[model samples]
Target chain A: MYVESTGIQVIETIEELQKTLNRNERKDTTVGFVPTMGFLHEGHLSLVSHAKEQNDIVVMSIFVNPAQFGPGEDFESYPRDREKDLRLASEAGVDIVFIPSVEEMYPADGGIRILPGRQADELCGASRPGHFDGVLKVVLKLFNIVDPDRSYFGMKDAQQLAIIETFVRDFNLRTAIVRVPIVREEDGLAKSSRNVNLTAIERSEAPAIYQALQSGVEMFADGANPEAVERQVAEGIIANSSGKIDYVKILAYPELGPVTDDTEEIILACAVKFSSTRLIDNIIMSTKDGTPCSE
Target chain B: MYVESTGIQVIETIEELQKTLNRNERKDTTVGFVPTMGFLHEGHLSLVSHAKEQNDIVVMSIFVNPAQFGPGEDFESYPRDREKDLRLASEAGVDIVFIPSVEEMYPADGGIRILPGRQADELCGASRPGHFDGVLKVVLKLFNIVDPDRSYFGMKDAQQLAIIETFVRDFNLRTAIVRVPIVREEDGLAKSSRNVNLTAIERSEAPAIYQALQSGVEMFADGANPEAVERQVAEGIIANSSGKIDYVKILAYPELGPVTDDTEEIILACAVKFSSTRLIDNIIMSTKDGTPCSE
Candidate 1:
């Protein structure tokens, strides 16, 4: 595979990206964007793979995005391997790699900031204060800079993808947002760079996350109540030798709604802290009454 | 001037706009939008005029945007003149007039919405709860429907304009927002559809709104302190035979900040209650210290 390290040519600043995209816009070229936080995991590659298939030119952005991380969070220690990531991205058939510095993304005295509202008050936003606002702010900045025809996002960050979909719908974003299914490891551990932080033993037990979620789905499939399905999933996770349940509540996907008997989608979402590494996993399954059962 | 007496195509459904925009997207034509609450005054015409100058196609939407109005406020009695607005917009060169019903915009379920953050919380937002949110929600809907290359807004709604600018910048909206200067009556009353409600006496007093604002600007030119300038403007408005000062203050133009000695590009904004009619006016002025001054 020919690996091209775009040392200043591909995209360095917002101006450079805008120039490239604007030129394409005039010529009517279809541009696609895949935004990634950089560690080159299979999950991110899946999104890139989808973007490459859909558009004439694919632009992949690899930035850690500090704003998305909260106080005492793992922003500084977030996994990054530029040389390896570039090699993987280049191999994945990405047309351009947009590597922008923090300074480039956020200028000094930048007054512009995006604050997500009520919907932002739920899901991951509830735990990580200012997380979605940061996500939205940067995503918007990237979208404006890239001005792509279609943007690709992986379902691994399910809530993030949902929020972006809302952003696209609510704000009338011009770019079409294409969502790809979450890519997982052979054992069903959702592919994540955070998987790197797991110990060998912890990694073996990690598939239990998916297993618990599946159990909840199976219960819902077998005609159990949504609450019963949620309870079962929580039980399964807590029963795991290495898993400590953080939260395994059933909610409406994206909206983070409470379980309602009348409605059909109750997302079975779970967060578990394992070996000082926190992992979140969820499943959206239709229940007997038509609610989502996320085990 | 060509006049199209197009009947109000008042459809509140977002799905329809989405479908229309998607269809338009296939043709790849430049689209421009002017979002307005139904009462089309000269202020709105300036925006439509600017939009006409910039884009291949123009869309002017008329909705009273209830979110921008506070409870017990003018939501019920706010100006609604579809027939007149249509004639005015057509004369100003609007290509499409989107008149969505409230049920269409807010759906029966009223699920999904937009959030206009901190900047929106200040200024008019302080008096009007959820005003910017409503503005954002509708603007996003219109943007999606029109998929405009450029959109126009009048600066007479200064706070609204700033909030929209902040929203676009923070959200990474693809469309370029063009702000048109405020249009005024010969007597200097800021052109508003609401002006139609003024009685003969109220109409006569309306001009005082502008005169008071002008006095504030003149005071700044005379080396008056920011506090003294504000006092002069307040005194002028109250002293008017038919004017009742609602608010007379000096502040930074874009940020709506408190006036300091170093403020530049300041605004002297005033609102006066003339019997039952409320009139607002402002004058832009520069400070000696190169910072915005507020009156």
Candidate 2:
């Protein structure tokens, strides 16, 4: 049922969500879904906005998926603000907000799992083993529950978006994937829920992560090879910020394969650790013209 | 497109099947799906019959999934009488038949896969590792393509049935799984596509496999423990037939857990090998009433 004040229908169980969607289904409504982990930011809201424009109905799911987090990761300390999220979602024109609990999502040991292949062995997946498998598992379950006409994802977590796209294509999922470009702060820090965890000093240094990616993109535009682009991005991050470098990779887009002369599209991506917060950002570009593909 | 002679819509691609099902969707049609490897027998048609009774549309998929077949198994040698199968499918009142080639199903190395947990460790899965993982993967893909309201499976592959049911429940799949009782020969042998591979002597001996299972069911009815029921079934197969016993055991029905007094339902299941041909059979019964649960 919808809360009168918010005018956004809130569904907490899979059954209830399906029932509500089924009612909409009779009218030939096309649904667009945006799945998030509850601590909503501009990046997530951007996805909802895209969904609203393309779909007759927009659904936003707020589930802090435990399966995707590793042992030392901040699953416990992850930021959450339900009231603020609902307010922002309503303003963003989201029609339904599904807030399922942990127990509700994982009622028992699912004895079945979705495992990612080689695309998961580098970048965030390398640092966080079993992360994409968990991500795919939850996303598949969410997709089955929502059965949306289209699902929106941001390119800030570029590798995650690629792997999810791969899953949908390989599995013959009905929902089309809509790629939403990375939404950034005015200074170019990719907006993330984890940005709230940064100290004031760390906050000022975080925009350097995206700045370094832009440098790499510029290097490639100037005819620099992948190795030089990766090195320049790595060096730029080190010189500009106190954050430790995690990785600066320029790989074939979506496939995440080693870039070669034949590669048409590539991604210059990086991750940085600043005391408590770890940030990731990337630029997907056409290798031919060396222009940003999605911006 | 439908072949005029058969009057059954035969689709070979996922896209066309979805498009056809989409047309059915607008009419509030409920679909029932039956997925099988080709060479349809009475057992497969029985599934279609159950599906016909339940839904407005029936989609049967025949894919000899390479993933579910282990090395040295009967995959390459597996029977395929497509012309006969189409005749039977049309005769059985099937609305649509989906026959996808291996390349169509796996266009590329699907880096993503569905892995089964402890439930797959015993019975057929023990000897055939990575088997149910393939089964679940293909089934999930087909379920996605068909988007059926209900799907049908036979209890002859009782362990596979249990695993599929578990997967559907754990993943919150919209498709409801309907368990059709195993169709068997009048002589008590379970009907299977592989039954044709049996030698004359082996074919004669195959009935003993089901007889042994029925004996075990009687033992359980007489208050025998799981061990006694298992041993009795094993000895019966060895005494009555020359076939080598693969496995004979009684376990809790769907979870495949060890049988305990608290277990309400149990399956007395067995497998046998005669030269190259292998056979499996099972009887699911209520512990309290000692009667077959479905049949």
Candidate 3:
């Protein structure tokens, strides 16, 4: 199913993707999937690389899902580089690169939707209503289409990763969710597709988001309570970044519940808005062992 | 994966069911699934028989989905005869019978749900709000668990069939939806588990619901408009039974839209409540050629 020129299969239709995957599945080939919005960065390629190592075949889907974007969001202006993305995907060892059009993905009105529960109420979902619902919708569709053995998601979008994990577990889906470490730049800013939208000044200030999360992680390690850790993180972002703080808090890891004495894992997370760009970063830490669990 | 005595494998947990199916699936065995609430009547057995005919292995699931039942909607008093259901399933050629406990299916607060669209609004959904949402939720979970090549659904619950079809199509699910025609009693009453709940007099009168749908089919065959067909069906139900009419509708099939000159297929459907028992029956018809497409 490879394109002769690139040696990477580029599938544009669901029928063809299903046909190719069906043939591979019959041969007991395990598929690892990485879903993205078509702007391949180091973060996305890291997921692809992780996928390639774990399974016989790697499938990367590049769909700029409109459902996840709210009004006034950057859906229309969202960056896309198909040519560069394919080259990066091929280099990353993707066996199949699924590039479905909006029409190809959603040929009809999607009467059926996956609604998130309390897990979607805070963080990014707080600012953007119905955002997690849209994410779950597209992910479920792609899961059904690809039928991958394992699906890879980066922890950079920690909340999105958490919500997706909850969905797969609750739905009893066969695909195992694999969490990859977030890819970051040398200056310690998390790699993101939206980073291109940042102005030079905003770009310089953006690293503060991760720095604040690290500060929160240190406070938690020093036996700070959840409230203290939250306040320190918020103050750090205010002190260094031109971006307005959207939210800064520490909560139980995947559950996103209130941190209590029994809670072992916690997430130090924050979102900051710089002019027209919004940036989010988080550090998952083990509260009991005093160690950072994820970047 | 068979229970030696009965020659039918009965799986109680998701893990065991997945193990059995995975083994079979690796051998390229096609699975045909029939999902039921477990008080098996002729209609349900018919679905099992259809599944048996279509695939190398037939899997039947029997669990009364609590999500689909509303408050005060007979969830507690729902009929169950597991021994009899097992026997019927075995006799009907079911290879694997999955009977998961409520706790197994819903171990935690299901923070995710499948919300259905407008196709749910007019029929049973109008009376039972959020009913189709519950239906879609359970159906999607079952589909994920089974991963069948084809799933059999009886057309007796016409709207349920339509909504399931829409969910599969919109979600781009791999399971092919196989529509089995309605199974009826000698008296032409549609066979249902709930029929046993009806009083003797009510049971005698219940056949009128199907008869009314037949009358509506004749009207449509005589070139009756949608409104006229709806009226005739309602009048026939009122004239023949001591029951209250819930709704009688003639809508474009599958889409459940308004029937116009451009419309080719339509559903003539009705619901009648006889004291404690409520019954629904429908006839899918082709308006363009003037014929009943389904019982």
Predicted model with the maximum lDDT: 2
Query: What's the true lDDT of residue A106 in model 1?
Result: 72
Kindly list the per-residue Cα lDDT of model 2 for residues A1-295, writing each as its tens digit.
5573868888888988898888335457889999999889899999998999999999999989999999999899899999899999999999999999999999987478889977888899899998998899899889989988899999988899989888888888878999999888999998899999899988998888888888789888888888888988888888988899898898898889898888898988888998887888899999888789767
Question: In candidate 1, what are the lDDT values of residues B1-295, reduced to their tens digit?
Answer: 2235463343345566556555325365666788888788778887877787777677788888776676777778887877787778777777767777876665422134556555554446665677777777677667656667788887777777777776666555667888787788898778987887788877876776778677667777777777787788778767764767666666676667776656667777766666656666676666664332222
lDDT of 1 by residue, A145-182 (tens): 78788999876677787778877766666689987877
Poorest stretch of ten by lDDT in candidate 1 chain A: A1-10
Model 2 residue pairs with clashes = none
Q: For each candidate, what is the lDDT?
A: 0.72, 0.88, 0.87
Give the poorly placed runs of model 2, Cα more than 4 Å off. Answer: B23-25
DockQ (C-alpha based) per candidate is 0.28, 0.65, 0.65
Residue-level error in angstroms, candidate 3, position A67: 1.2
TM-scores vs. true structure, each candidate: 0.87, 0.97, 0.97
Question: How far is A106's C-alpha from truth in model 3 (Å)?
Answer: 0.7
lDDT of residue B35 for candidate 2:
94
TM-score of chain A of each: 0.90, 0.97, 0.97
lDDT of 2: 0.88
lDDT of 2 by residue, B84-179 (tens): 998899999998999999999999874888888777888898978889988998998999888888999999999999898988888878799999
